[model samples]
Target: MFRLVGSSVQLDIQDPKPEFHDLFWVINRENNVVQYDNKRKNMMYYSDYGGRVEFNEETYSLTLKNLQKTDSGLYEVRASGDEVRVVAEYRLSVLDPEEAPVLTHQLSRDTCNITLTCRGHDLSINSSCYKETCEEKEVTSPGGVILSLSVSGSTIICNHSNPVSWKTDVLEMKELERLCADEGEGEDKVN
Candidate 1:
């Protein structure tokens, strides 16, 4: 499961047999997250999960809040009776939201060269635009963030995205066209 930072996630027991299992324990790898004692109707949150964890008595589910990047790990649910048995397992990944991509353009003659840089991902896309159309490229960063540059009419669109979130930036090219047009007119008048 992929989640954004500061978000919340609920881990529920899959195919729960409420009658067979009364004691439920949620574990994040080797660390104990929370445990519910159905017989005594008591819930305990261990380690640093005191107020960040919530346990539902009826569904034997655990909800974690205010997630951080360090919380990405494998989680397991163990139900104990005569012997401890694993009921559900989950691999969680927490990522910070993507920032808007930076779109920069340089105009010369009839073509406008553009570069799109994704913040934090260290990925960039360089393309050329002619008149109202632009070249498009899609690049994937080393950390799995995706950077894309596309053209919509006279607007250049740059998008930065990951599994958890996405952001975009736009550059309008109408001014570039006007500048180039004026430069062309000035050359004609001088000739």
Candidate 2:
């Protein structure tokens, strides 16, 4: 059983026995079995039931998006014919996007390193970082992904992706310089 929390629900099934060529089936609550198109390799939906709905055979998953309350019901999936029947109940609850992520910068003058950190409400899962000119990197940390860019350009773009969506933050080198200069000035005053 899979819990789909988003607007679309995905169902994946695995068949190790390899008894059936087609691995899954979707049935509505009215006892009508959803038809699958072997040529298109997707589930076919009629205008009576609603236009054509599709599913991926390779992944053994079906995605139903823009779901309405009427879409909520019991969906049955049969794998390998009668081998296994997976019943799933869907309850759709919409939620607003949480707070925007807070982007922070860390600069090391001695090392010429600039790291941009994006902190969000949820960070338990891994996050990824991408640069416009550079390759993307993934980091596993409690504070999310830290994008390390050379402090030479005026602007650096960093993208963070979680399970839900991707968020981008643009950092300017001038801001890092100002922050480093401010810290240095504070230290000099103490000395």
Candidate 3:
């Protein structure tokens, strides 16, 4: 996936030092020409939908600003040196920040079990822990979901994320032991 909306993404050419050729064009997935700098300094051929395009001749990198879902797709940059060649290729994707997951603890006298949940706009998943460590998380969105369990000095961190963003909830064993007296639910959200 690519950067989020309103962010800029730069697809750079592999070469450290690039030659400033007279004819260069960057095309998007739909065959829509995004940019063109013909021997001039920072000029683009805005034919179809220009949106927000920036072409850097010095580095031969194309930066698309104020990104949107429509901008997600394959991108190809063709430059003319000895002959016309596609120097760079990219598949970009953009999505909004997912909603933060919820973590609740079920403390029964002497046991601590943490529940982790992800509530995104279009996705929801649940996982739980029964011991000092958590089990391998199983999520619905296989391509975009990442669930990890890490043990800190005195806490266990349950992190949930997608391609564009992530959120975490911590379960401190010592802290829970202290707060369990209340016999109520507790939640910790990470931004």
Winning candidate number (TM-score): 1
TM-scores, all candidates, are 0.85, 0.37, 0.66
Clashes of each: 0, 0, 0
> In what order do the candidates fall by lDDT, top score first?
1, 3, 2
| lDDT measured at residue 101 in model 2 versus the true structure, 0 to 100 | 51
Native-structure RMSD, model 3: 7.2
* lDDT by residue (tens digit), candidate 3, 56-155: 7567677777887777878776666667667778888887765565555554443456554534444545556554455544454655766555557677
- Go through the candidates in order and give each one's C-alpha lDDT: 0.76, 0.47, 0.61
Candidate 2 lDDT over 59-80, as tens digits, reads 5556666544455456655543
**What are the per-residue Cα lDDT tens digits for candidate 1 across 1-191?**
99999999998887557444345554565787876776778777887765888888778788999998988888888887777778888998999999877877666653344333333357887777666667788989777899998777777778899999999888777765775677678778979
lDDT winner, 1 or 2: 1
Clashing pairs for model 2 are: none
The alpha-carbon deviation from the true structure for residue 2 of candidate 2, after best TM-score superposition, in angstroms, is: 14
